[model samples]
Target: MASVTLSGLRKEYGDLTAVDGLDLDVDDGELLCLLGPSGCGKSTTLRMLGGLETPTDGDVHIGDEPVTDQPPYERNTSMVFQSWALFPRKSVIENVAFGLKMDGVSEDERRERAREMLDVVEMGEFVDHDPTDLSGGQKQRVALARSLAIEPDVLLLDEPLSNLDKRLREQMQLELRNIHDAVETTFVHVTHDQNEAFTLADSIAIMHDGDIEQIGAPREVYDDPVSLFIEEFLGDTNLVDATVAEVTETGVIADTAFDTEVDVRTGDAAVAQGDGLSVSFRPEELDVERVEGTDGDGASAVTGEITDVLYRGSTVRFYVDLGGEHLFFEQSVGADTAFSAGDVVRVSWDPDDLLAFAADGARVGRGET
Candidate 1:
């Protein structure tokens, strides 16, 4: 197993910069994901690391070896793509053996090694079947086996699960995680899908506008996002425009645009009174009930009318209109009574769960609210 390092990595096309000054370290045997929306440079970064695309500036290293000038094969890195990239005219075994054969392995050794890799991906039974005859999942497994057959120091995946149906993709996600655990090979994956990145990677490196935004473990990134873009992109969250009214011992009190003052848990830093802030919280953290009195069971409460009710699986989502501003709150089945559209209710949440950021939207939490 080997680690990967990128120093001052950049890619440009005339005036268009696809990747800009990226500095990242993918730990040995750790699966790292480059995640972002379209044109955010995750794929471009992956291509540079795989040696498929040349970086305009920077150095790439695999373990202790500097591979900045090496070709794809010469860098000991194998890439799996969303297209599967399997051979239509070849059998599953043949497709898996192609890389080994190209590497000048003996005919007998290539076949044996390919079969072993196929078994690792649970496609051993499909070895003799034509790749054209297999389903999307089977084809992807063959593609993965093909990459592993070469025993490369690093494996790169570019949106490899994006083409599959929802159910199949979820199933493959678990299978892929299990496979990575078994291989102990360093992997760098690029994808725009948040769920895919969260489930597959040991840590996620978020990219935006050709730059690295935030890189951390899944929970750390999701729970304490470094910016407004991160909070909105990684999950469903609410951001209320507000101004700090007072800085308390535990957190800070913010006065929202709705004319309500809320106590927000200081995340990474503290802000003083009069500072502009954006208060954030997940919909599931909200507590909603009929407004019978001023008391909200100690949580900050807001009066609103339900404008919509959405039923999704065991959870029901309620969209509320609070004086022309819309906010969403959700509850699981049997955890609380469901609300109907047009119902007058009060939405409240724990102050400690509320997070506030600077007006610029950068993360400022560390209990600083």
Candidate 2:
């Protein structure tokens, strides 16, 4: 296992800058994921690390060695691509043995290593089968076996699970993380899937438009997204424009966009009076309950008619129209949620779940999302 370092990494295509002066250090044996939407330079960054694309400016080092100018073959790194690039005519064992064969290993040793790698990926029974005969998931395992057969110092995965079905892709995510833990190789994975990064990475580097927006643990980045872009990109959130009314010892009080006052947790952020704020919270953080007798407990933060109820198998999504402002709320699967469109309901939420961000999208002391 080896640590990878990138400094001032840059890639340009004519007038467009794909990667703009990026600096990142991935620790040894850590599974680091470069996560972002398409056109965010995640794949480009991965290509540069794999030596497939030369950077316009900057350096890449694997451990103590400078490998900026080296070709892919000399970098001692293995890549598993989205297409599972296995030779159609080659058998499973043969494809896995190809890397070892290129490195000048004996035929017997190469086959032995190939079998071991196939077993590691749980594809040992398909050793004699051609790549064309394997299913999508099986082909993926073969590709992983081939990459692991080389005993690479670093393993680079470029959305290797993108081709699989939803269930199979989720299964592979766990298996891939387990494999990384067993081998302890420094793995750098690039994907636009936020859940993939949250599930597999030791640290996530959120990329946006050729730059890193925020990089941290999945929970940390999810809980305290620094800006509106980060808040919306990482996950689904309800964003409301509010004005900072008061900064209290526990949190901050704000006048919500819908003409309601609410207190929100301040995560060490500074807020000033009359500051335009954007409040963000996940759908799960807010709940809808039956509007029983008395209007006590400040239960009615906002009253709205149910505009829609989307049953999503494991959970149901309720869209409420609070006057002109609309927001969605989610709840776990239940047959007792006798809610439908046009039902009057009261929505309530814990103030601690709210995050505040400035109008310009910058984080104020504990405000802004």
Candidate 3:
């Protein structure tokens, strides 16, 4: 396994830039995911790393070697595509050994290595099966085994499990993580699926408009986003519009869309009075209690009536109408005192749990408190 590095990497198509000047480092044997929406340059970056696309500028390094100019076959990297492009006419074992044969390994050695890789991917029993006869999940395992048979310094995965059913895809995510641990190969996976990245990657690099918005472990990025875009893209949360009413040493007092003033904890953010801001109240961070009436007056709590209750498998989501504005919170289905629609509830949260953003969508304050 080898470390991967990209320095000032860029890619363009005419006037449109697919990848801006980007810099990133992947530790040796680490599985780093390039995650983003479509048109965000994640796939393009992966293509560049695999030598499938030439960068408009900058360098690509695999370990100590500069490989920006190398062809796909010359680079010590193997790519598993989304389509799982297995040879239709070839047997599973033949397909797995094909790369080794191309490298001129003896027939017996290549076959032995192919069988070992098939076993590694739990496909040893299907070695002689036709690729066309295998199920989607089985075909994916064959494709992964074929890539691993090459014993590459780095493996590139381009949304390999996207074609399977949701259940199969989720199952494959765990198996893929286990396979990565076993092989210990440096991996760069590109995907737009948030849960997949969170499940498979050691580190996630979130991309936006051709550049990296943030890069960190799954929980770190989800809990402490650097901007409003990151916060909204990471998960579901209530964003209430407000204007800063007063700046205090601890944080700020802001008039919210719920027709109430709440103290928001902003740690050393350059905020002032009258500035328009959007405060994110994550559903999981809220505390809700069934109340009798809307006459309660608390700075940290708002009285609202439940407008809708959605039963989502093991959890329930409750949407509340705070005057004209709406906010939602979730609870486990097994929790005591389940609420229903039209129930009066009081929603409260700690001031420090709030995350405020400015008009330009930049996060207000240093997130470290």
Point to the candidate with the largest lDDT. 3
lDDT of 3 at 236: 89
For residue 251, model 3's alpha carbon misses the true position, in angstroms, by 1.3
lDDT of 1 at 88: 89
- Residue-wise C-alpha lDDT for candidate 3, range 1-369, written one tens digit per residue: 999999999999999999999999999999999999889999899999999999999999999999999999999899999999999989999999999999999999999999999999889999899999999999999999999999999999999988999999999999999999999999999998999999999999999999999999998888788889888888889999999999988888999988899988886688889999999999999999988887664778899999999999989999999989999999999899899898999999988889999999888885644
- Backbone atom clashes (below 3 Å) for every candidate: 11, 9, 0
- Count of backbone collisions in candidate 2: 9
User: Which runs of model 1 end up more than 4 angstroms from their true locations?
Assistant: 267-273, 293-299, 333-336, 367-369
**Residue 354 displacement (Å), model 1:** 1.1
Worst 10 residues of 3 by lDDT: 291-300
TM-score of 2: 0.93
TM-score of each: 0.94, 0.93, 0.98
Quantify all predictions' global Cα lDDT against the true fold.
0.86, 0.87, 0.93
Q: Write the per-residue lDDT of candidate 2 for residues 230-258, one digit (tens) a residue.
A: 88888887888888788777667888876
Residue 75 miss distance in model 2 (angstroms): 0.3
For model 2, give the 10-residue run with minimal summed lDDT: 291-300
lDDT of 1 by residue, 264-313 (tens): 77843557779998877679788778875445433287887889988888
